[model samples]
Target: MSPPTAPSWSLVPDDLLTEFLSLLPVKSLLRFKC
Candidate 1:
């Protein structure tokens, strides 16, 4: 049997991701990006 695979966040929709990111403060988001 094959090994179990890890779940990926890539499966999340771009719009959903954008919404979450938009909820963060500009400074916090900038720090996270870096």
Candidate 2:
């Protein structure tokens, strides 16, 4: 049996997500595809 799939690190914490994204490099952030 396969394990359940988990959300990726791209799924950062709400506040932290925004904070992280705000600080992410343009190239790396572009890979997020919004």
Candidate 3:
């Protein structure tokens, strides 16, 4: 049997995602990068 695939974030638009990320503080962004 094949393994299940991970969910994708393709539903979200790139511009919207970029705006959301920009609103986050540097510390929060750093934490997510790890």
Q: What is the C-alpha RMSD of each candidate to the true structure, in Å?
A: 6.3, 7.9, 7.0
Cα deviation of 5 in candidate 3 (Å)? 6.0
Q: Write the per-residue lDDT of candidate 2 for residues 1-34, one digit (tens) a residue.
A: 6754766754667899877777778757678876
Which digits, one per residue and each the tens of the lDDT, describe model 1 over residues 1-34? Answer: 6754734556778898898778777769789899
Candidate 2 versus truth, CA RMSD in Å, comes to: 7.9
lDDT value for model 3: 0.76
Residues 1-34, candidate 3: write the lDDT tens digits.
6754633655778899898788788769789999
Q: Candidate 1: worst 10 consecutive residues by lDDT?
A: 1-10
**Each candidate's TM vs. the true structure?**
0.43, 0.35, 0.46
lDDT per model, in order?
A: 0.75, 0.72, 0.76
Evaluated against the true structure, the overall lDDT of model 1 is 0.75
Question: Comparing candidate 1 with candidate 3, which one achieves the higher lDDT?
Answer: 3
Tell me the lDDT of model 3 at 1.
64
Candidate number achieving the greatest TM-score relative to the actual structure: 3
Q: For residue 7, what is the lDDT in candidate 3?
A: 38
Model 1, stretches more than 4 Å misplaced?
1-7, 26-34
lDDT of 2: 0.72
Residue 9 C-alpha lDDT in model 1: 53
